[model samples]
Target chain A: MTDTADLEALRREVRSFLAAEAPTGWRDASRTQDDFVRTQRDWFGKLVRAGYAIPHWPAEYPGGGRSLAEQKVIYEELAGADCPRLLLSFVSTYHAFATLHECGNAEQKARYLPKILEGETWCQGFSEPGAGSDLAAIKTRAELKGDVYVINGQKVWSTMAQFADKCLLLARTSSDGVKQAGITYLLMDMKAPGVTVRPIHQIQGDEEFAEIFLDNVEIPVSERVGEEGKGWAVAQATLASERGLTLMELSYRMRGALGRVAKLIREHGHEEDRGVLRDFGTLVTQVDAVCAIADQFLDNRINGIERMGDASIVKNAYSRALRAYSALGLRLGGMDEQYVAPITFGDLNTGNWMADFMNSYAWTIAGGSEEVQRNIIAERMLDMPREPKGWVL
Target chain B: MGAVIELNELTDAAQKAFPADKLSPSRDESWQLAAEMGWLMVRLPEEDGGLGFTREASTALHLEMGRVLAAMPLIPAQLGLQAVIASEDFAERADWLERLAGGEYAPLPMLSAKLTQGSDGSISGTISGVFEADMAVAVVAQLPGGYALVPLDAPGVSLVERPIWDPSRRLFDVVLESYTPTLMLTDASGAKALHDRLSGEAQLALAADCIGAAGAALDMTIEYMKVRRQFDRPIALFQALKHRAADMKTRIVVAEALLWKRVRDESASVTELAAAKVLAAEAFRFVTEEMVQLHGGIGLTDEHPCHLFLKRALLNLQLCGNADLWNERVGREALA
Candidate 1:
């Protein structure tokens, strides 16, 4: 029976902190904006010093004591302020740290949790070239040798492997049943022998993803979270956190997109045109609908009665909203803005618009494609008879 | 989520409650079963010889009728009766509904649907498209000249069956040169109120029927895909086909949501009901069309239920109002 007034005060305190900490000169900063890494690291450090980072973890764990409500406020503040935490804080704020909060053993928490909170470093080694959506299909084998297991596998799309000091690796421990039963979740040192990271050029001209090859990488068996062949279950737990935490970022993008469109239309001088008005009206309706659903999703989570399947609805709705907003931006730009070559800022703003448009394709594909989401929704929520599993994994 | 409308009888009793033999496959026996059940008087009060139902209850009944593709003229009949009762003009017709519910005064007991009170103390509207016009015992003709309860058998009155797409429904075109009067009222608010009340009723009927049809249409498509083989496998196994079926399910789900919203939302009214009709009709047409396309050539035939659904789609599309118009008006209603 927490008091509403108390929650409001905590929320206000977070928001007030956000207003103070919002980096100067950060307004719609593009993906390739210079000084991003340095700026992000600096921002992450300041928040850590302020004891505001790792807000979801309890205070006793060398983390800020905050309820889910307070944790959401922090996410909202960071997103609303347009603070860059995606690649920078994902491992600390989302992956490894999230795993520690959820499934970490007592000793594991005391060790890996502290490094993540101060943003010292961590990286995910979940996806392999052989395993993407079919995560359990990963063939990264970790064999027990003495007190340690030697790991050998390739991981792709390791977002920040260039700077990450450690890799939260998932490796196969047995080849029984399906690929899932033979895996284990482990915290591995990135600097270990036979681990190599190579950046991949993205469509957006940034190396946001990488290909990591592991050749007999050796790590203590103690790094494993649970039994050797239980990786798939732990991986599922970690992946669940990805969906639960990132929704606020989607909302922020949607709001900013909505705002930009309003500004774009007004600038384009079609504010009063019938077609444009209708489009605006429709967009407004959709935005309201999305916001309502998002609010409801949050309420359900807070009430401790939420459906995991509904996360798909939010992902689908949010991506589509972002796409809708981006499409509208392109339309407003017309031939001059759309069907033209990109230029630097002030030359043509579609570069930013185009960047966002390109970025949204990954929203669906990144955290399990919308098609996979449909399967989850159908099987779990609607209780549809399972389609014979189509994938080899 | 339809308003907790505890009806006196069944909810889907609109047309389905009528024995299938009497109301469907051309409704030749409506005179015996439909009229006998007091389907027309479902919305009327017991004081007025109806079963004493709420507006939501009555609307729900008609909706259920549409869902089953029932061919009873409940909307027009009960609407006309409501007017008669409200105007205190039911002195002679008072026993009509009692007999209706008792399975008497049926076979072809029709009161009127087409008479508009006229000016110059004369009623003159042609009242075309009168449902069950030929079967009417009399035409409730209202005009500027006067209000007349003229028997359909009267020489001056004409009831020509207007070839309707819904073979089950008998829409009539009435031509009256100058009909004799039954009773005229200087004020017609009673009739107007009934008209107003019936608009909501028609909306609910169209929406609910569309909901039922949409469900049926999706079922048909899913079943068709399950066995229809292409590329050496059932088409339903194809991801492309599966996604289309999934989209249809989404629309039906939305339509169902809107149907409940129309009946339950505090804002539920004429406009909300109309929106439901539009959503359901569009969904019905979309699903039915996909059903046919999936069936290849067989779906376009008269033998298939697809055409019937298509007919209802086209009919419902134009009925109440078109979807775009309704969607636009919903926003306007909010603004107002």
Candidate 2:
């Protein structure tokens, strides 16, 4: 754990770095998907060169070896400075890096970990057309052929897959035993022959996620992570890579963006409206509580006192608060918000209330759906009995 | 970390003193026990011949008391004791602190006082929300002139017990009839400072109480759900019921996290502290509401303890300003 003095010093150092290099007008620059990708890449490269990115990586890698506390400091500074979040490179630096560091062979790690720092982006191909919340029931087929695996599957909701250079592909290698038993995790080149990536047009007019179609896409056996049919365990490592930090950062960002609500209240001349004030006040407290819970969750993890379903609680609270924040803004923005406006590419609280309200759904629906998280909280944390599985319809 | 360990030790001692099974224990007995435990001076400085524990220590103690729905007036007693401690200018400050720390009760009222100062330096009106004033030697109140300790035995000073819905504690109105103030704590100008300080403390203490009580309420509900069977199975196995329990748990944990966060922050505003309390009290209300419904017909009965939690939650919501009052203030502050 970093001491208080050292943490303050690090905060100062980060503040200085951010003051010098934080991107301004990036939101305006990121009106289009390609421009958004360019802005994200530029900011990420700057962070990497300054040794601020990948703080969770091991000490062998540059800009790595930071404790969770230090990582928290960095993220707080990043979010506080209003810098564009590294949205495009998120899966590459977190999910890919985690899978390689934890489960990949030495050759795979050596080949991929360094490339991630050098701007090789990755996307997850875990959820299939049929498998969304029940991810293990994927029907994607991967058959072993000589020294290569021919993959044929359709992956939906893969975040920014169209822009990724590689894919963390999960496909079924066997139909034997349980549904989870046959899944295999492979690192496949996104540009491989027969691989197709089509961006999903979101309701908010942003293509933040994509649908990847794999038709006999060949991946060498060397690219497999862990043993065949044991990908679920390795997938756990990838899923658990970044805990608490993202939500905590987003919560703080939302807290900072409360000014947008205040601005709306002022601009709409609701300053003297007690009903509006009360609503704003309630929303403010909700957002503040979310920030508090997120911070506490990270602190617990840092202190090794995190319990099961704690992350789920944080996620649910944050998503709910995000909904409340955007809904309030949308209500106040009225007909103005309904007007079609150019959406901000990679932000949740952009004052574009309609887009933000639509974007808030991603939090409740992705990572784990709200219902799935509720189950985790109930069955795991609360010790409630789980429903009997495998019941026929 | 040391403070955390100290808080745990305090919590353990509180649990040992007041077990979870004993709901609404005898107020007189609990008050005596709390006094003997030196809890009244948990926040008093060491130089003042009291235990020099931080606000966290008191918060922890209050949480334990809340868990069993203890009927003791610890919150008001602690606030009154703090009022004495804050009065460095009072001539009898040390004597009052010794008396308060030594088991003599002088409770700060939970509600406001409606008083008018007579031309002859006397005050008359009613000080409301003084919990267990029948047992108090005096009541610390905000007089029109300033803050003072009005002795219960003083002529024209009387106690009128106001029965409240929350049976866990007693409430009273300390009615005054042109009673002359003898023990002055603060003058008019200094009153706001002390009020802000004590209000912040009261909010945190109430928040801790809400969190602990909400936790117990949730636990009790879950226990009942585990035993109450429906559709040939325990209701806990039902996903719909389980989801509600999960949501209840989420509200409690999230509110509690905010409570502890604000409690640890030395610079938190009174409004911020109130926000924490508001979230926590609402969480308690939510949990108890679910607790009753989840328990079905049994929860609605007077014999069951579910209503006890519900009553306490409702009362706590109105204490130190209700949600609407605080929420509006919070919004106004943020707007400013």
Candidate 3:
């Protein structure tokens, strides 16, 4: 509930900070996965020192405790300045921080929270090959062996796990109850014995996510986030940690990237083509609407008026718009896009239309697939009756 | 905060006046009720002898009207009143405001006028898209000279009802055969500014209407899905149908967010405003289309309210420049 004047002041402060310290040409600098990670790390470090990186953190921590409004301002400035998004440290500062801050023991919190600011990156180990949108169906197994939790599982779709120092692992400790009830959340070290990190080569030729295999990886019992078999609730916090801001930032970036489509229009001599203009116009409006919805979602959260399935709507809208944006670019880019231009890693709207179109699938498929989001909207928000459970094929 | 509270109060009052159950309530009664409620003057400044509420107030009122699929022509009437209020140079501005506030209907045309300025300084053409002109004392038209009040009873002026698919309201073509402009609101030099202002307002108002009606349409579809059953269970339980409904809701919410954002932003360009309207109207069309499909066979009947919503959504898309026109303009602007 920041007042307009204070919000404007914060915006100005962020704008000035971005002007001074924001990385330029980082997209071009991020040609390889390693280069992308480097650019991401450098920008995250700069933002951390300038007190704009982790505004959602508590006041006791530097660059923390900013309101949602303030966080929005920072993200908006970062996106507007075309700065590199803090992709490498995202899970550390958000998911890890949230899980530790909200549900961790004091020792765990003190151990991890400070390290996060010091550039210790983390990745999620919740999704499995068989789990995905049905995350609770994960078959990762963990058993208590004295003071240590012996873990054995294969976790896929863990973003940046290949480079992560720690993994927020969700494993099945008890299979006697519902799928979600048996799960346990543990902070496992990525460097533990028999822990294998294999980066998943994405369709766009980037390894933004990886698969982690644990063959007798031992995590101390103290690393558990909550009571055994109660990890589902704790996982909710980690999932909900970063909301509104990311989508808002992405949507704004897409809106700004409309210039790419304009350039295509000009390059192809489609300026007088009514059909192309109409399609571009439709895409522009869709992107604008996505931005609006993202902004409104944040405003609702700030005002505490957010309702069930609000986040789902924002996600679906943003993903659909992202698809439309890239598709339009791909269409206009035509034979040129098919010739394989080098893609800028870790960015959705990199002006490389083919790669962008392929990367857009990440948004729709990851972070709760579009279909899953629709179910949430219908079953929860619209009060539609759910299907009978325990149906066998 | 005050504006928000007032908007809420206005919405509540409107819903109470035109309950959702009654679709296409008698147009005459609704118009009278709206005028008596001071809705026609919602945007008139206090100094102009009318309610000095902001555009949000009228937008709120329009949304409420849209929810019930009200038959009244409030959108154009409000635009007309705004046009008169903006003409501070017009000698009879005060008189026109008083007359309009007192329920003398003067509506701004939603479509362009095809006119040829006569050699004798008279204009002859047909101004189309004047909603409910049969009830209007005059139509506020943009002649070649400028924006002027074309009195319905004046010589060479005639109204021809142009039957539209949307039965909730009437549309007419205001034909002028060598008609002289007596009530000039703005000269040719000032017309573009006034046109831009009115167009922006029209976009917001229409956007609000689309959002409101789209919400209602979605609610109706959901209600039908829940009650209507198939395959030994309620269809609402089916993922296929439920997902469609969810997409419908998403479109409505997203377009609505854009509408309110543009409505609150004073510096939004005309193209930006049109972009908002285009999104909202498209959403409305999408929702209504889904509404009919989701409702099944009953939706095809003339007696059902689904057709009403569908027709209105379709018409709203065409109003204030169709999606193609606005989208091209939006594309051009973004390119520039």
- Candidate that scores best on DockQ: 3
What docking grade applies to model 2?
A: high
Residue B227 in candidate 2, Cα distance off native in Å: 1.0
DockQ score for candidate 1 = 0.09
Query: Local error of candidate 1 at A11, Å?
Result: 8.5
Cα lDDT tens digits for candidate 2, A190-251: 99998999999999999999999989999999999999999989899999998789999999
Q: Indicate whether candidate 2 or candidate 3 has the larger TM-score.
A: 2
The top-ranked prediction according to TM-score is 2
lDDT of each: 0.64, 0.93, 0.92
Worst 10 residues of 3 chain A by lDDT: A18-27
- The alpha-carbon lDDT assigned to residue B301 of candidate 3 equals 99
What's the best-to-worst order under lDDT? 2, 3, 1
DockQ, per-model, please?
0.09, 0.82, 0.88
Residue B73 in candidate 1, Cα distance off native in Å: 7.3
Model 1 alpha-carbon drift over 4 Å, by segment = A1-26, A29-98, A113-123, A159-167, A189-200, A205-208, A242-314, A317-321, A339-352, A374-393, B1-212, B227-234, B254-281, B326-336
Clash count (model 1, backbone only): 24
**DockQ for the candidate 3 complex?**
0.88
Query: For model 3, what is the error of residue A208's alpha carbon versus the real structure, in angstroms, after optimal superposition?
Result: 0.8
- Please tell me which model should have the higher lDDT, number 1 or number 2: 2
lDDT of 3 at A243: 72
